[model samples]
Target: MMAGLEERLDKMELAIRKQTFRENSGRANEVNFWVFDYDPKKELEVRERIEYMKKKNEKGTEGFQLIVFDLYDMIMEYLEEKDFVNSYGRFEKRRGFDYIIRAVSTSMKMNEDDSILIRKIVEQTPENAVVFLTGVGKCYPLLRSHKILNNLHQSVLKASVVLFFPGTYTEQELILFNEIKDDNYYRAFKLVK
Candidate 1:
């Protein structure tokens, strides 16, 4: 599985460089979005592959730049900077899930509008870059993959965005971590098996 995934990623990188990678055609056969899905269970393996790719990039593999946005690390950094850990440490009575939601919400300032976090992600991304989005499993109830992808703007997504989902991605529906079934989203394409 790991070797196969690496081969797929290599092909994906080639496609991205070509800038002709389309998920599917629109109503008039127009090119659709450039969102690719990968198996979530291979998160660690994917991370290693990305690290290797980054090294290759450093060694002068050019054309498209790879930028990785690890959600778990980003959220943890935010919580620590905001001093939420100390507060949580003092109030050890709260349930783990509740504490997590509170911490994530407080750190991300999640409101009725959940797109804020996604927008922040887009803002952090560089122009004309291939992005690798990871750490979805760690953010479970706090952040849903479908929610972020659904809310993501095409304009903001200058290049292909590969979401390393830690779950099953069927034709249209996204089963997050194999527990939650998100709504069917059509804009993105599933990486071929």
Candidate 2:
């Protein structure tokens, strides 16, 4: 009964379109954060639907904005903009994978209030825009989904934030790709059942 991914996505789409999902609606006390978790193997299909929904909603025919920020792309762009792209690869090769992990973590300011990822998202968010955070699986060993959620808790993201997790959010912790179990608990609710 309405168990297909497409059907679930359609339900989520309808939910976001509701006026109650925006500011001045109900749930003002909550963070308006949500997780749309799915099977890791179906990342491609989910992404396709997300892109399709994004194009459809971003047109503002619904009187609200749907903004998607692929975290992996953000990290790449952040590194590039800061001129770290050149040394990032060489540093990994010379210093090693473990060392590169720390470097990237520090560079991204993981879980910090002033993190580059958080700042970029906060800056680009317009009034009545629903933020969709994606690419969690791709940012592995670099960006943690829980850390991003935790950091967003401290940031000024007033709009609804939905994380398109390529994993399972067990309502308590995030299991990245459904293999790596993350103990970092976040307060975001599931966008749809």
Candidate 3:
């Protein structure tokens, strides 16, 4: 049992290293990452998602890291990514970003635990990188009401967010949360389909 666990751990480390090496290989000192769909079946789903990205991006001839994390693992992964970028001479100007598309599926008001962790990560990232959050239903109200989020610059939002409100949103809601959708820094709601 211990040996099996050890092998799995080694595999995980290798996967992360492979991603890091690929993304930084030819991007002119830039870091490109994709935070894809998350699922509870982490090991299998994540690996499959990475493989899918690998195939999809094959024509680009450039390396990029594609990450997927379960809600339980999101916080730690964010911190790990934080440290990883900092170590590579990008302590503040980190180039990586994350996506949270499970917000609606996981909680009616957004997961406070995840929200706090994401807030910390965004607070720590540099001003240039973008973070995106997306999911079905309106997470805008909750996000806007959070006192900790108001002060966070759009440039440093824990992640560039694309709240999946699903239905047409009111102008008032847009006005209240438009900064969250500022496209000057990064693209929001990049249509995958």
Candidate 4:
């Protein structure tokens, strides 16, 4: 069991690195990973997140994007603080955020349409940006849409590295994840890995 667990963890890390490469290709920017534990509802935390992001952006690094899956409320609050207003009265203006946050639920449920939307959003990102996702766990799907999966598989070809966080999981779950990140599946999703 221990050996199996180690193998699973190793595999997850590889997949993450690969995904990161695909996401950052041809952008000519350095990608940095930061994990923060904060509640978006808290004012102080929101401020801190904004400060951190601004500091990174100031560096003007190309292709730098942060991926956050959890603590979405904090991100929302930060956006609100910056006056990017999510909703308004009569006059509604949609604001763009610097980081990408994917809850495990959204990531797992993402279909082709969602993937396209996400791709479009990413295309609009400025320099030295970050995308984040938090609260990753097994027993839950990482990506939900088979259709989106199909689309992403069609494009990704050569992902240099993959990274995965450590967690506990059952044997069957590990196997399923392994299959999802498999190299062959990259072509099917139009994603490079």
> Largest TM-score belongs to which candidate?
2
Q: State candidate 4's TM-score.
A: 0.28
Question: Clash pairs of candidate 1?
Answer: 40-165, 40-166
Give the TM-score ranking, best first: 2, 1, 4, 3
lDDT of 3 by residue, 1-193 (tens): 1234234334533443453433323234423322222222344543454456446544644333222222234433544665642343352334432223233223322334335545555555443323223321133332332222233333233233222222222322222222343112222221121
Clashes of each: 2, 0, 8, 53
**Model 4 misses residue 22 by how many Å?**
8.8
The lDDT per prediction is: 0.65, 0.85, 0.33, 0.33
- The parts of candidate 2 lying over 4 Å away from their true place are 24-28
**How much is 10 displaced in model 4, in angstroms?**
16
TM-score list, all predictions: 0.76, 0.93, 0.25, 0.28
User: Which model is ahead, 1 or 3, in terms of TM-score?
Assistant: 1
lDDT of 2 at 116: 85
Please give the lDDT score at residue 174 for candidate 3. Answer: 25
Whole-structure CA lDDT of model 3? 0.33
C-alpha RMSD of each candidate structure in angstroms: 3.9, 1.8, 16.7, 12.3
Instruction: Encode model 2's per-residue lDDT on 144-191: one tens digit a residue.
Output: 888889898888788988899887777898888889999877888877
Error of 3 at 76 (Å): 13
Q: Candidate 1: count the clashes.
A: 2
Q: Estimate, for each residue in 1-193, the C-alpha lDDT of model 1 and write its tens digit.
A: 3237777778766765555443323335433334445566677787787788777766555665677877777777776887887776665555566776766666575542444466667787665566777787887777767655665633345556777777777757878767788876656666544
Query: Candidate 4 — which residues are off by over 4 angstroms?
Result: 1-109, 113-124, 127-135, 138-193
